[model samples]
Target: METLDKLFEDTLRDIYYAEKAILKNLPKMARKANSTELASAFETHIEETEGQVERLEQIFEMIGKSPRGKRCPAIDGLAEEAGEIMQEAKDDMVRDAGMLAAAQAVEHYEISRYGTLAAWAEKLGLSDAVPLLQATLEEEKLTDQKLTELAVSEINVEAGNAAEKNETNKPRAPKKVAAK
Candidate 1:
């Protein structure tokens, strides 16, 4: 049987580690994003992440655990994959599209973790942790919705047009010259 403390500590480690990785990754993501909207989104999230770190510290203090981060290999891999997408994407709109997708991936991870933590906090009767984690979770969800809105409202259409143009520009096989 796992003690509540162990579960809570593990959850704290997961979020703490994820936030640290996010701090490193968001700047690169902002750089890669094409649209002002996308760039702003990344930049805003960077600020939010800083606040999240502070909140985590408060949670740690409440829990009697010194604030610390454990290694989050999952986020490391996800950030690497997003970087590769940025490198491979050609057009500005296409890159923005990829950026939105990557951002959503990150948001989903955060939502899942935060949701779990909130549930665990409630189960463990850690009322204080519940509100703290819930706040972060709400932000994660809102960010995800903004990314989706960006994708559907503009980025996807622009990328689609750019892709179509590239397809049209490709040299058609030399039209069969009628060998009279």
Candidate 2:
């Protein structure tokens, strides 16, 4: 059986790797975002991610382990999908909406992973890890909320309006073809 320290170390490394991976990917995501608000959110989160990395290092110190990461394939795959979504989206608002969806996916994953880690920490009596994970979980939730707010207030509505404008701009088929 894995010791409590081992499980805690494993989870910490998982999140550390995930955070580093996000640091690499977020700049690209921020660049691809259509709304300034979305871009700004990504930018802000990138900064938060940097701090999260530092916090993970602190956790490593608390646990008396070297600060390092195990490869997090989950975050890698999610980042890949986010890149693909940006490439495939048709227009600015659609792209922004897609970005929101991708960001939300990331947030949800982090929430689940952190929540599990927090529970495990508490179960194992790793009091130090619980607060760190909880803090990260809260940040992820807040990021998701901000993205949802952006989607409702701007991106989705803009996409709808753009669709309506496109429809209005299209030339209607002439009625005289029946005579021929």
Candidate 3:
């Protein structure tokens, strides 16, 4: 007999897997973004995502489970879609637009998962997990909003206003990071 408690744990593991998958994918997305604003947003989200992963680990502790991830096909698919956008779009602004949409897709998926996990946690009487899940949920929603704002305020304007010149279509050289 399947119980909500079991369902909750499964969902938790799914999100844990998704977050880890997202961590691996974000740097690639950041490098591939032509818009500095979009790239910077990806970089910032990496830190927020690190915090989200920590919260997921804490929730696992409350449930007496080790921090482990079940394979999440949804995240895998989203990552594949992002990769496709990176590969297919040759124009800088075009790539930026596609990447922006792909990123928001990831955020939307995360928001949905976190919302469900938080609601289930509360219903299951896991008070400790609720706050942790809710915190990540809020972060996901905020990231989604910021992405929207970025697209509207900068990327769209840049895309629309870019001159019809060869220079506008060229790929950018990524900033060299200092090795720690």
Give the range where candidate 2 is weakest over 10 consecutive residues by summed lDDT. Answer: 1-10
| lDDT (10s digit) by residue, model 2, range 120-153 | 8789787987898789888888888988888889
Q: Which tens-of-lDDT digit does each residue in 1-180 have in candidate 1?
A: 278779778878887998999899889989877788889999999999999889899989988999888888888888888888899987889888887888788899999999988998899888988999999999999999988988899889889999999989999787787887
TM-score of 2: 0.86
CA RMSD (A), model 2 = 3.5
Where model 3 places Cα greater than 4 Å from the true spot, the runs are 161-180
Question: Which whole-number lDDT from 0 to 100 does residue 2 have in model 1?
Answer: 77
lDDT of all predictions = 0.88, 0.85, 0.90
Question: Tens-digit lDDT track for model 3 on 45-132?
Answer: 9999999999999989998999999999999999999899999887788788888988899999989999998888889999988989
Considering every candidate listed, which one attains the maximal TM-score?
A: 1
Candidate 2 residue runs with Cα over 4 Å from true position? 166-180
Q: How many residue pairs clash in model 3? A: 0
